[model samples]
Target: MSDPGLPPLSRQHDRRLRQMYRSAGWPCQDTVEIELLAAGLLERRLEPSGREYLRVTDLGIARLAQALDRNRAALDAHEALVLRVAEEAQRAGRIAYRGLGLLAKPGERWLQLRPDVYSIRNTSVEDYLEPVVHEIKVRRADLLSDLKKPDKRAGYLALAGECYYVLQQGIAEPEEIPPECGVMIASASRIEVARLAPKRPMKPGFATWMVLAKAAPCRQPLEPEPRL
Candidate 1:
């Protein structure tokens, strides 16, 4: 839990803090800087030449460390879920890929979408490939933010026959997600499908086929040796 007495700081504040820590500490002279100064996270320094610069205080460094740890933990959780989804797809006899950057023209403008897991059925028939996209989210804030972007959903729909949102358990309910997408909740033990995604009759474009051809799919885990 955070201190209720202190003024609330957002990711933007943490980002600025990291930027100042990495750079020469020249002030941006923006509202973010003002808030950081007021919060004692930043201090102004006067050099002998009368030039002014900003410096991160001890408190700021501590805050930055905390932010980094939180980000790392979130990333770990996200990646774990991504691996689970990919493995599940593989078990279903589909070829799965992770972190593939594909171009999608959901509307008039082309957008790049990197789904957490992209999979296609293993079949010789092109129409039966059934490409699917699985987007993983471990944080509620991230899930909510993604829900607001209809364009991103459109891009996923454009690239795959079905799109699904794989969420960390307790992050959200299936009803909160858009009707067009399916929802799956992942716990420590297993993944449960909360909703089934609607399957549309679609085929991957030439660009998508080219990208998949050039990229490698997720490898299956090694099986244990039989007992002697």
Candidate 2:
């Protein structure tokens, strides 16, 4: 737990603290440093030659650990939801990939976008592949932050015939998301579709095809051995 008496620190502060702990404590001499120093999370040291460097205090280490734990928990939640989505796709006879990177040109500039879950219908016909992109968010802050990036959303739209946002339950209402994208709310029991994503006609470019060919799709679960 953070000390209530101390000034609240942001993730940037935690990041700087970790960087300083890893490196030779070269000071950035910025407001983040001042805030950390004020909160006693960092201390300054002077050598005999008058060179000054920064050091993270014990309290800072504790804060870093806390941040790491929170991040890990969020990551676990995100990955679990991603796995569920991928499995759901497989059950629907689609080939799904997690963490697949691809280039998208939503605007004049091409952007690199890695949709949390990318899938295509399992079919022999290339035109019938129906590529889809699913972006997962377990945290409201992350979802809101992503919403602010129109270019990123555009990039996702460019790559898929259908784009969806799979959010943890209660993070946000379906109305909060843009109309172009679909919304799925995930709970402990099941995932429910809040809104259907509008489908568009799209053909995966040669680059997308190359990447998909090289990457592995999520494996289907194994069946139990038959009893004799």
Q: Give the TM-score of candidate 1.
A: 0.92
TM-score of each: 0.92, 0.90
Residues 51-116 of candidate 1 have per-residue lDDT tens digits of 999999999999998998999999998998899999999999999999999999988999998999
lDDT by residue (tens digit), candidate 2, 192-215:
899999999898998899999999
TM-score result, candidate 2: 0.90
Backbone clashes under 3 angstroms, per model? 0, 0
Model 2 global lDDT (CA atoms, 0 to 1):
0.93
Please name the candidate that would achieve the greatest lDDT relative to the true structure.
Answer: 1
Predictions: Cα RMSD each: 2.1, 2.3
Please, what's the RMSD in Å of model 2?
Answer: 2.3
Deviation (Å) of 158 in candidate 1: 0.6
